[model samples]
Target: MRWRVAFPGICVLLLIAVILTSQGERHVSLSDGVVAYFKRQQPIFAEKTVQLRRHIEQLQPGDSTSLLAARQALRECRISYKSIAFFLEYFFASEAYVFNAPAKYEIEEPYIEYEEPVGLQQIEALLYDPQVWQHRPELAAQATVLVQTAQDLHALLYQFSATSAQVTESIQQELIRIMTLYITGYDAPLLKSGIAEAAAAMKAIDTMLTPYQDLDKKDSIKYYLQQGIHMLSTQPDFDSFDRLSFLVNNALPLQRLLLNSNHDLFSATALKKDVFPHKDITGDTALGRRLFFEKALSGNATRSCATCHQPERYFTDGLMRNRSLTGNEVLPRHTPGLLYAAYQYSQFWDGRVQSLEEQVKAVMHSPQEMNANDDTVLHRLHNMPNYRGISLLQVQASLAAYLRTLAPFNSLFDHYMAGNKQALTDEQREGGNIFMGKGQCATCHFAPLFNGLIPPRYNRTEFEVLGIPAVDDLTHPLPDMDSGRLAFFPIGFYKGTFKTPTVRNTAVTAPYMHNGAFRNMEQVIDFYNKGGGNGIGLSVPNQTLSAVPLQLTPKEKKALIAFMEALTDRDPIAH
Candidate 1:
């Protein structure tokens, strides 16, 4: 009788063991799960897109209620897009631009392709204008186009497939997207719904990561995601939102957790291939350093790269424009600092060259600049004890390598982002918020690099037609005559277009803009506050900068300048 009673308990234990074995044997495909998640999200996104278009169709310019309804619909559409943005953007980047691109005409070089401003950003620009009635037809048309693209995207979603590796990689890229674009109000400048969109994106990432929760034993990623979403949702105010605190406390920790969990899925070496395109030579840094200060590379043998790019002034000469080779006239454009030059996709103000090596060679040969003859320079280098066997190519490589070392991410602002709360003051924090929100500086000067290199991909650099004045006289300004990228590309949209440089060391690198018209950060801020060159009454039909005044208070402007000042590197480049 006792044996019979034990037998039943044994059977129960055996049954439990069998169930556990079956559960362990069943393999869950993360890729399939991710694709299915996207399919479900597509319909939601499509419906929201249709809703936005309908709201726009019924919009009455003078009707306040209608306008408010349309704005709410726009917010909904943006949030829905954010939910699946990671997959959509990673797979269909070109098609994705149709749904949300910048509100300006753009020319893609090499192909000479022209793209008109369209999508949600274009609609937002029109709707948020004080004179919405004036742009009624344009707003309706943009909304209609957006709905059509959404339909196309929905159809394309049926064929979507991703490897488990891609799913994790996409999540990582989305994290970068949130940090760079979404939080900065890049896409939703007028609506200021970037925070909400960021939350939606994180939620989607959290859902995708659910299958891997067991893999993350600590569950730190889930905790941070929830925390970040809560903080974003609670803070509705765009200008006063504490972005620094959010980034340091939540977003950064989650990023580290994800990166550590999936070391095999993403390799640092592979990502560096995208970031630093060229093959970086080993054991050449010391040689490159010596060549950077070598005066013999120039035609006159009087000026080295350091002469124009002085280390004392953050690698800039601190002039409106440096003197030409003969010292008879000034160089055509302003001498930009070399502090973070290597981080850009393209070099120079006009973005004519795509590599630092190419830029170095161009400067060496330019008559108005270094004015060096290849044979002569090679001969001079051969005589030097350290650079005896160096060819012209080696010289170019060395100089490029040296430039790559200039990026030292130890600024006060960087420390603040890295979790040092006292690195920034209250005024500096307010200034940073304004820069990311109302000022719209982050739209062009993206975070981390704070340059024109587009984020998430970082494959292309952006050029903008700011329509800079020839002088600082906003009251009686003249449009700069410099053709910029147009001189080489011969495209109408490229007129007066220049690459956006990093503003990291701007407090030290004075004489701003392509022409160096603005002498100080205050002047530059004022120029932008008044709405670039177009708002100041200059004739610039192709100006890409919005012609709307920033409407900043005096204190805000001072704080903005102070925030930029805080970007100065902790370790000086002067040795």
Candidate 2:
């Protein structure tokens, strides 16, 4: 009798366990898949995705924070419906496989909960593999059916919100394509005969993205397409339609940050192939730009190369005049700024030098500038404690290497021309047209880089002689005024010729002209409006400035100024 009673109690205990298991298994399954996929797809989201998925398992409908975090992580990464579907596909595939979830979730967290019985059932089925492996050959097939069905539902459900609404159409296209490609290969019954339709759409979609996918068009569309791809994340900026448009057309993202930050940040942001591009002058060019500012390596120990080519005020000293180490007011053509100098064919106001390396060593040896001999510089750098780390000769070569990387790529005009329609104000666009056409600025500032002409064959620089009176006495030209390139090469063609500086960073590096004769953009345009240097009523020699006055209205003059500002790389820095 005691044995019989013990048997009934054992049966009762087993029944209790079953009821508990049946109730909780759904929660366990939901938590597992949700957390697993998040970790797999977005390694960044592993911790939070797991935590939230666990909370989702136990909570009553609307009773947890996980759902909110799910919405948020999705929001932050700008993950879209396609990304979500892609996540779910790989996430649930772990059920038949041993994919240990890397993310640890604590399901006990407090939250407003929501529960779906169907979602719970799918999660449990994926978690527990019964002996169906031996008895039912169709069980594996059922797994495929269950997972695909769940993904299709997710794709349709994602459209209810505004953030994913934009790419919802694309998400559908992608999902259908996935189903078409691999779902039919499953050892299962057809859920529906939509396979043929899905296959047809996949081909069509491939053909459709073809035009937009051309490598030639990549730069133009990258900014916009990234928006769509980013929209795949949860925390996308969908509220601001204007930003949505801008983000879609321009993908500055981490690249802009990396460019502006310190070296560690640059490396961390993109340790691999993500770089600032060849135009920024990587490697040899980067080395050259670095040596530009280094002072101790220079001769006399007092001057750095930047003493002439300053980075502040957009790579030029803001001063109207500069003094030499010899205490002579040579004025040296007002020290030309080196903004985007890499884009220019020539190096300086006189174009005496051909390459930046030659220019660096020339200044080192010049009696007027650094006044240090190149050989002396080489000797001094050879022993410096810090520089010994780098070959002294390498540092010499490095400065030239670094100078080539000094091109000013970040400017408003670059943004405007890069297909961001809203980058320039309407007035600025009109001004650009005027400058290029009727304003005659484009006659001198040509295409590709908008300053100096670059031929396909030779990379030599050209110089021009523009006659303008020296500062202070506009009536009489300064005695012993420099004749520019002519004095250097002693060639008549080189007479009064100065290598044209790239007008890219012009908005910031002012006082204007090679001599910095004009103080501001307006004054410069006004000088031009009066018809070059002569039209301004200033008597000058070798006057190559347009002799006839431009006769522009004040509005037109303002437009010209705005356009010059727009020429700035990236965004302009106010002084």
Candidate 3:
């Protein structure tokens, strides 16, 4: 009975001690420590802005530096190309929030009795307000009081933009560290108490005072606070190609449009039709697609896809050496003009890629191409003004949807499809017959779209080994060769196999074959006339090219070339 009575007296004595500590002076430094940090970071941001502006000023239309910057901007702009894909994953893929808890110091509410370390207790009081309990009922129910308390620190960060990044980052780190420590039973009340005072002081003076901020309308320190804290909270993980593809193809809407200036035909083509109606079209175009096209989408400070695939000359760069983001020569392959590529099931001469979007991704990330990765490109895009809420996945999907509208098969040949009689000449007619018969070009290059397909083509991509060697090496063909489809599959069957390309714009896509080996139509015919590539010295183990020769005379060769030339139409083939 005496021990129980003494226990109450001991509790009262301890309560007095707690009150003394709770009302004590703050240990935290605001001026010298927290506020001083952001003041220093301002110049770094300013310098970066200045350099980019100067570089833009120096950009002469097609200069490399400007192009790189534009590329970066484009990459940033495309984050919304999908939706909140990454956001959804971070938000819902897991059951827990990145930071969530409440009641930082569970029982230590300020009252007549004091708590240890006045600054820390004040912070805890702010975090553990009765309003906070009401505001976060869901958290409170789960006893996520600690989580709410931790999250409140991030909220404070957003509110405390007056601090320098160094200060902001330091405070953020401190909050996270303390939360972890507190969770692990560490004593850190003094450290936190001091930080609360620092926050109050910075919030006091972080606004623009007089004349300078007026010209630029500078944002309050809080703007940086929100942005900085939001940025720090985000964590990214790359999805696999299969998963990424599924997410993109399913989650995002594909907007198909007609770049064709003729609105009537575009309307007719886009309209519901019997044979070739497009089920994929959402019947929309980006209001500013032409802006994107002309502006360059690389997101690096460099070249656009248009830099290579120009609309004129059938969508090629029309340059011998394609410049890469690293400002280096892109060796090996010439840029294929973007004509009738919609008919192409495979992309690249070696057919290394499967689709236009995949091809774009390849070029964007290639060291000798755009010389960038997805994140590097996306970071550049995120810095832009117009791209405020867009995600990286959205941008990729948008760009891809744009590419889908590049189908222009309409030439004089399309006129023939419309039942025009005089579009073909006698020579072209005779050559067409030969193409179907003895010429045997039509055996590989089929009709309608002329690109290879297995009648309503889906996943099937065909590869035949056509041995067309370098001009210099006619006699001894080197096996130290780029074996096309063999590179992708790496099997006995795939050796020397390359995809069969559409003969549609064959006239303009000069220097033919996977390696761009042949210079003229005559050379191609002459080689074919002597049977397959094995007729020369270069022989693979299982060559599927015609062992039987075309045996064409000079006239037949010229006539066949004429037929190919007639296949050329104006850019943006009429639907």
Q: Which has the greatest lDDT?
A: 1
The runs of at least 3 residues in candidate 3 whose Cα sits more than 4 Å from the true structure, single-residue gaps closed, are 1-300, 318-324, 327-330, 350-353, 383-386, 456-459, 472-480, 573-575
lDDT string for model 3 (1-575, tens) is 00000000010000011101122122123323333343443343234323433333433433556445522322221121111111112223221122111112111111212212112122232223334323223322222322233233222223443222233223322222211222111121212221222122222222211111122332322343322223222311111011112111211111110011222111224221112212232322361243235333554546766666666656665454455566655556556666656445467765666555567667766777666566755565567665545554455445555665666656665564344547777677556545544455643554444544322111233456666665525556554366665576555455666666777777776656655566666667776666557777666545545444666667777777877877886565232
Ranking by TM-score: 1, 2, 3
Candidates' C-alpha lDDT: 0.77, 0.43, 0.40
RMSD of candidate 1 to the true fold?
Answer: 11.4
Highest TM-score model number: 1
**Between candidates 2 and 3, which one is better according to lDDT?**
2
State model 3's lDDT. Answer: 0.40
Could you tell which candidate, 1 or 3, scores higher by lDDT?
A: 1
Clashes of each: 0, 44, 50
Ten-residue region with minimum lDDT total, candidate 1: 1-10
Model 3 lDDT at residue 313: 58
Instruction: Estimate the Cα RMSD of every predicted model relative to the unseen true structure.
Output: 11.4, 27.5, 31.3
Q: Give TM-scores for every candidate, taking all chains together and pairing residue i with residue i.
A: 0.89, 0.48, 0.48
